[model samples]
Target chain A: MIAEGRIVIDLSRNGDVRLTSNRGADVARLLVGRDPREALDLLPRLFSLCGHAHVAAARVAVQEDVTEAEAHADTSRVLAETAREHLLRILTGWRVEGAGFELPSPPVMGLVKNMQAAVGDPAEERQVSALLAGYLETHVFGISPAAFLKLRDLAEFTNWLDGGPTLAKAYLCQIVAHGWQGLGAVSTQFLPALSGAQLQALMAEPSFTLRPEWHGQPHETGPLARQSRHPVVAALLELHGAGLMSRLVARLVDLAKIPTQMTTGESPVRGQPGVGVVETARGRLVHAARQEHGQLKDYQILAPTEWNFHPEGVAVQALAGLHAVTGRAEGAQALIEAIDPCVAFEVRAA
Target chain B: MCLAIPAEVVAITDDKQTATVSLEGVRKDISLALLTDVEPGDFVLIHVGYALNKISPDEAARTLALMAELEEVSS
Candidate 1:
């Protein structure tokens, strides 16, 4: 019978996991395996949020000696599903965490009312129910131009009984125009303006951006969760605007972009060492891995939360930026929230 | 890293194990596991689905306030 192998690991923010094996196994032997099933089970758990990434890496490490075509398609499907799940969690967070003000709106209030009713919170139920009615009334008369405009053309239509058609139509036009402008900004001003290759290169290096002091210092992550969606320095200079609202708007816009991408053939690349890097509502997230021999090996994930929530160094920069602009405790908290640091994923191991 | 952070309890359940805490504009559920007899508005260190310790709200406020004050002085 084959002896049981054990590998213990400690992880650093830079996607490096230190592994110590106690079964007289080299990297190759540990990865390739005598009993492939049992050997694969010994890999260390890395970040919980990026379990798919870790598994993919393991597959790569094992397949180093094999052909790429041998990689399992089922595994690729699982990884993509994991990525989708992660994205959904982020979107839910955006609605609940990033856009609390919008909650008072009718459509949102309806959802909240249902949730409260189901949860059996009488006071909350009353509050949400009342809010939902008020939202409907205001939306009908076009009193809330922004709210009316935001929902006018959506499939889930709400009849605002008091809203004037003329006003609602005008507001809708304005909202659509604003949305287009936001998209243009994202495509031309924001994304295209930055050199992807250069940014990726910067990521590969060790720097204060990733390793900052101050234990559990808050940083942001998520699709629309933070200012990371906007090029902070560039936005300050060009847009001359920086705050919670601006950051939230950017994320909502990003949400509008995702469904199309998901519907198209833009999912995570399977089997090969494909990395999905994005500036989430927080700062930045990188998912990279290698798949080999129908198993996962050598996975690495760098999440925005890791950079922002570092115990020491990089957090100072984020804090300094927030302090410079808002200069208040609430403002600092807002900035921290703007980063939306995901501590859950940071400390989790799969 | 998942985007979770430590927050102060603005209110607590009778049992003191669950609490309402605020982070940014959002408020959510937090478990009080690491500290004893936590009260309203006491800061706690939170990470990955758990509150690890009780942090002083005064300290958090002071640190943030100081950052703001320093930024003003510099600007």
Candidate 2:
């Protein structure tokens, strides 16, 4: 099997933090010179975490033309996948934060499996969205998605967090109790919406794929950046300034709105040397392909992990400022989770 | 960039909540918390110490061969 790389986070006693990743950026080179359709089919086998997103991006990148309906369907599938991903993270990953929090693994796993099973079938879009919304209502929010979305201020948010004992609530309450709401806050420049041509040009540079920066500045992406303008997240961001709380709440905001936000217009370049950009669970995922006579001459993928986990990127900047101590490891790990790398990670404190 | 390699389940624990999986002769135990109906000799995709799902053996073989090819290229 291809190497499933790991991220090593070392926290020193003097409050210094270093992040190292063995994640291979050259994995996409495997697609070079293959037929675009063949590469698209192979993507699911390659990327099991966000496999649907990868296939969707590669499909658009390789398509000579896209119909309105096809674009709408693709957008729907990606949204469903994103919601599934958020649910998995909230249910499974957050369970480690609270001693009393036990993951309801069976139902959560069942829901994710059902959602994944429907990913490639556009006819199952409505079913998938309904499944995700129902799971959120029963397992996560303990309220309807609509009601949760209407929560506009920090008071309402805290009231909701205090009311539930689910994994999401337990972990969030700890964040509040520890006063880690503002932990990891930093000056933020969100990645902006770019046209296909603009994105293609930027992605052509080799350094851009491994250590991407927009206009010489490290910009943040993913649910927090995408949903920062939402009323609930905006209220949190206004209070906390894009810290752990704001980031986690933004993921909820994004997941709650997925059923209603399926009409995103993806403007992929139409022919050879095509480029497709998609918003995934972690952040923006870009795929570029250059084909001659129906075979790819060049292929490249720029995943969100690279941008958020860049040597001088958002994750490092947030972790660097903290005073490394015994009790701070939990917050540091939570911060990394809020930033959300696609690979496995280890937190080593010394 | 989110590539997840599949591993072969060589043995199941007595409690049935975990399994020992093998990949290219390397062995490690993984939780079966996210999946059910897994058996020895099944190929499963793993992430963060959990087995995400089971895959067909043919698909498993194809992926392993491709991964070997990737190792050669990167090496």
Candidate 3:
């Protein structure tokens, strides 16, 4: 049997949390020497979550330019997938009430259907977007996505949080009631967007993917960093300082913005010499590919998890700061959830 | 990066809520909540104790061969 690596958080009796990543299998190495198109086709089969983002980055990495239609198709697919991913994580991954919620239910199944439709046909983009927006409005937000997106401050957020009986409200409420809004705050910087050539150069260094740093500092990425400048997220950063509350809320804010992102079609940053970067649900996903002797050679992937979960990155820094308080495991889990590692994770006694 | 490993469904529970999947020889119970109409012998991509989706046997074989190649190279 093959080992699909996962993150293990070992918490000592003294409330010091240690993080270990077993994701040592360099799967990207397999793509080397293969036809770029074949490699792209294998991406979705290899990665069940964020597969669209993977394919999009790989497409940009192997091709120097993307036409308007391709870009729109790419943006639509990724955004649709992102909406489904965030919803699944919040609904199924969050174990807020001690025992986690059961799955295969209507909401979860609905998301899976939409997720499949996302990777299917370009003409289905509008239909998928409408279904997703309707799902969020009726089930999670208790308000229209546009209305939720316009909430700009803590008061607005708190009112919305308390104004509904939605699952999103319940999870956020638990964090607030437990005063975990500020738990696991860190001073890690946000990763800056690098040009395709710049990113290609960075990946040339063997260790860049495992412990990526922007100008020698390990910066956080993903939704929180991406949404840091949003008015509501800005207010959140000011209040919580990149803690559990801000991270969770940032995910919500990002989800609420998906429909607009689909309709508007934000141009993705291009990568020259076959390097492509895209801001995925979890964070930025970078893929670098170059041809040698008429064949694809030297392919590398830098997933957002690498940046946030680096050995000396934000997750460890935040978890290590936990004091031996009551319910330390729950706090640690919540913090990890806020950071949202893309892989499976477990928290246990050291 | 999140990489999902493909496993064969050996036996499904009576409730149809979960399935017993075997990866090579390793066996585990995975939630079937995210999928429908899965049968024994079908290959599904397993991630974090959940079966993301079902795949054709040919597709599963190709993916596993690629993974095995990577493992050999790393070793």
Candidate 4:
């Protein structure tokens, strides 16, 4: 296994969200000057949480495409991994805070099989939907998928939080209990859709693959960015901005969309200058490769963590001027986890 | 793709999604959101915050021994 990367965050008396990591260096070492095939093979080994999405991004980055069946398979696999990642975060978050929760993995592989069957037959498709609805109701939202999907405003979301038995409600309660409402506030600086030329310019830096920037400013990628288009997300944006709660809720809610994406998402293939923009469970991931003479001439990967946790980026911006309702130490840790670095992190109060 | 370790579930919550797990007095909350069947006292392989699989005590010991051996070789 690729050793999990480390992040060191320092919360100073002045309330600075000072964060640092060497994960980019690890990625650069693995990718730069390496064969595309080897790097693609290593993607899953390195990124265990959402390996399928990493693989898909690499395939897209290499100007590769899969048939419709393969594309559906890839999407379904990634969706399964994403749901697992979200559940893990929730389970881990609750437990670390002293919740006595059990550990039981969802039937990820089985869901993929069922989703495949659903792709061809309506009956199996309904079965898949009903199955997901049951699981999400019991674990995620405490409401039917239809009701959860019907929530289009903060009022509805608030009602759901007030009475819903879902993990989303529990997570919201945690944030509010910690007095983190409007805490760790980040601007909605979505990474703009890029042209091939722009992508080339962004990837020109030696550190681009691990820590990409647009116009020299850091942005966010991941569930929050991907689901910013949803009605509930839009309401949250208007009401709460992108805080810790908003980010976490967006993550859980994204589970509702994965099945649909699997059945209707675009082909996971692109041609030339292969710049693949994929949304992993954590955030947006980009993999681009340039091939010449039947060999990889250049390759780069941009992970969501790189953008959100950048030294002077979203994490710092969110933590700036944090009031620290609890203690600086606890508040800082909460804020960091709110930004949710894909890798493990260490917190220090100085 | 990753490694998980055997842990004992000491307590379970009302929601059944979170539980307290222990490994030698150290405790953690493991998410049960993924599995259809699990309970406190179950021994499971833990990774991140999710319980990966159930294991027998003997099997857990054997896996740990192999892991320790691999660490030694790597070192």
- Return the TM-score for each candidate structure: 0.38, 0.92, 0.92, 0.75
Q: Is the docking of candidate 4 incorrect, acceptable, medium or high quality?
A: incorrect
Tell me the spans in candidate 3 whose CA falls farther than 4 Å from its real position.
A96-123, A267-269
Among all candidates shown, the one with the greatest lDDT: 3
Query: Could you give candidate 3's per-residue lDDT for residues A143-231 as a string of tens digits?
Result: 98999988877788888988957777878888788888888878768888777668878988878988888788788998888888888
Alpha-carbon shift of residue A129 in model 4 (angstroms): 4.5
Q: Chain A TM-score per candidate?
A: 0.39, 0.89, 0.91, 0.85
Candidate 3 docking class: medium
After aligning candidate 4 to the native by TM-score, how far in Å is the CA of A254 from where it should be?
1.9
How large is the interface RMSD of candidate 3? Answer: 2.2
Query: How good is the docking of model 3, as DockQ?
Result: 0.60
Model 2 chain A scores worst on lDDT over the 10 consecutive residues at: A263-272
lDDT per residue (tens digit) for residues A130-157 in model 1 = 4433543342223432343244322322
A40-108: candidate 2 lDDT, tens digit per residue: 778887877877778778878887766666665566656666776787788666754426655456655
In CAPRI terms, model 1 is classed as: incorrect
Candidate 2 docking category? medium
- Interface RMSD, every prediction, one decimal place: 20.3, 2.2, 2.2, 6.9
Candidate 4 overall lDDT versus native: 0.65
lDDT (CA) for every model shown?
0.37, 0.78, 0.79, 0.65
Highest TM-score against the true fold, candidate: 3
User: How do the residues A95-142 of candidate 4 rate in per-residue lDDT, one tens digit apiece?
Assistant: 334444343444542554466556656466556756766776777778
Candidates arranged by lDDT, highest first: 3, 2, 4, 1
Give the per-residue Cα lDDT of candidate 2 at A41: 78
